[model samples]
Target: MDWNELAMELQKEVSGQVLTREPMARHTTWRVGGPADLLVIPDTIKDLSATFSFAADHALPVTVLGRGSNVLVRDGGIRGIVVKMFRGLTSMTIIGEDVVAEAGCYLPFLARAAAVHGLSGLEFAAGIPGTVGGAVVMNAGAHGDSMGDVLVQVEVMDSSGNLTRVPAGLLQLGYRTSRLMDTGETVVKVYLRLRRDEPVEIRKRMQANLARRRALQPLNMPNAGSVFKNPANASAGQLIDRCGAKGLTVGGAAVSEKHANFIVNKGRATATDIITLMEMVRRIVWDTFQVHLEPEIHIMGEG
Candidate 1:
């Protein structure tokens, strides 16, 4: 059967919002990308499982999105089903020194929630714009701390629709990657171990982190946080700056003048523009310093 036939059958089998030819730009941070064959926003774990099962039965490929902060969807768009665990899955609970966060919970929201409950470990994540699930998949971090530092365990659903809880050690988190991205298991819940601190102190630290980010990042522009990862003990932004890749432009995408690592969208920037700019920066930096900058953002969809 064709995708339209599968969509019609899925509408009857699950309780979730389903859309065909959904524009990827509307769901991504960069605001660029074409359409997906199918987009499903599951309201609950059962609904998500059912959707996955339906895809499996149809032999359809799957792409799961978090809060869309660290991804760049290509202009050609994605094929098959795109599953987004949002809205209904956004829940947080404080259990003593531990915080239980649903996958859809945004990093900043989760950090604020933990602070309200007198938690301290999440203060470092206050400026990270991705979701808890996305953070786990990429081991997202800033300053000197990271998600793996506070993560106790993660509950994930396999592609087979089976749920499993994996410990932090087994997650293989390092720099900006985790095993989850390669394994393609859907992050459902996260258990975080935090410290009890004065709410005022926690908020102050969060504010400090935010202020630092503001000073170093292009927060006023439309762009993902960092385009490239730092290599070894060196900084990616500093390297880009040294190579004079800053202020470089490709179409409507240009490296942020404020920060060399960020490639900002100049209003009408397309996915191709962003990708082209990134490639240009990589090539220049490599030739100038013999150091290749690896991309921090996840690029998805077809070519």
Candidate 2:
């Protein structure tokens, strides 16, 4: 598709970094992926819109990513254009009892900011490793509180680069799914309504959440967080553990002994290894419990 030529044209169209055959491994948390045909890291909203406009003009496919958590890019990498939103759109402000954050703001950092501002609702997000855009799109949650609970509204860019403000209710946020996932809209900013609380108490709660995550999750390893979603009233991890799937390995990917829901890269793991291990665990859990486990993490790109 003459990706180098497209990269040069895209660079001229937007004030952002444009590269061809950029390594996807460096962008994802799992640290394993092939090279993207074209990648753009926008410096501003205008840059993002221009990049999208360029893609549209070229009739190219587009993929948007932020923080790269809870996502696995395949070993063949992604085709067309990849827009990375992290590090470019991270601006946050506290307004009265609400917090307005840009899409790329780190979720953990936003949680800490809310605590510092004596806000109460985001304490559960202290341990989540993702960005506001990705979290809102996926309805990400921890400790029984999801992004749907506190979100007020969001600014999103359509595939054609048109911007609009959408209320939280319109997002159809439910159980780690959102309308944005289906619509292919790119979230730009998020508005969250939080209650005022004692700063000391908020910090205490955040600390507790972080401690629990540290004790339960495989935080030291390279992984895309939980592999499977909990089915209806049952925990996915408990089911997998009961099926004796922990420590199961396929190449460099293994089900984390510390957390059955996680598949960690021991070292030199490929996307194929992770996907193979995930299917194996899914089959074992389904065979034993008769529950069809669904993936929680987003799988992207070609095999």
Q: Judging by lDDT against the true structure, name the best candidate.
A: 2
Alpha-carbon local distance difference test for all models: 0.89, 0.92
**Which ten contiguous residues of candidate 2 have the minimum total lDDT?**
8-17
> Per-residue CA lDDT of candidate 2, range 1-303, in tens?
888888888899887789899989899888888888999988889999998888889888999999888889999999999998888889999988989999989999999988898999999899888999999999999898999999999999998889999999999999999999999999999999999999999999899989999999998999888889999999999999999889999999999999999999898999999999989998898789899999999999999
C-alpha TM-scores of all predictions: 0.97, 0.98
After superposition, the stretches of candidate 1 with alpha carbons farther than 4 Å from their true spots are 1-4
Superposition TM-score, candidate 2 onto the true structure: 0.98
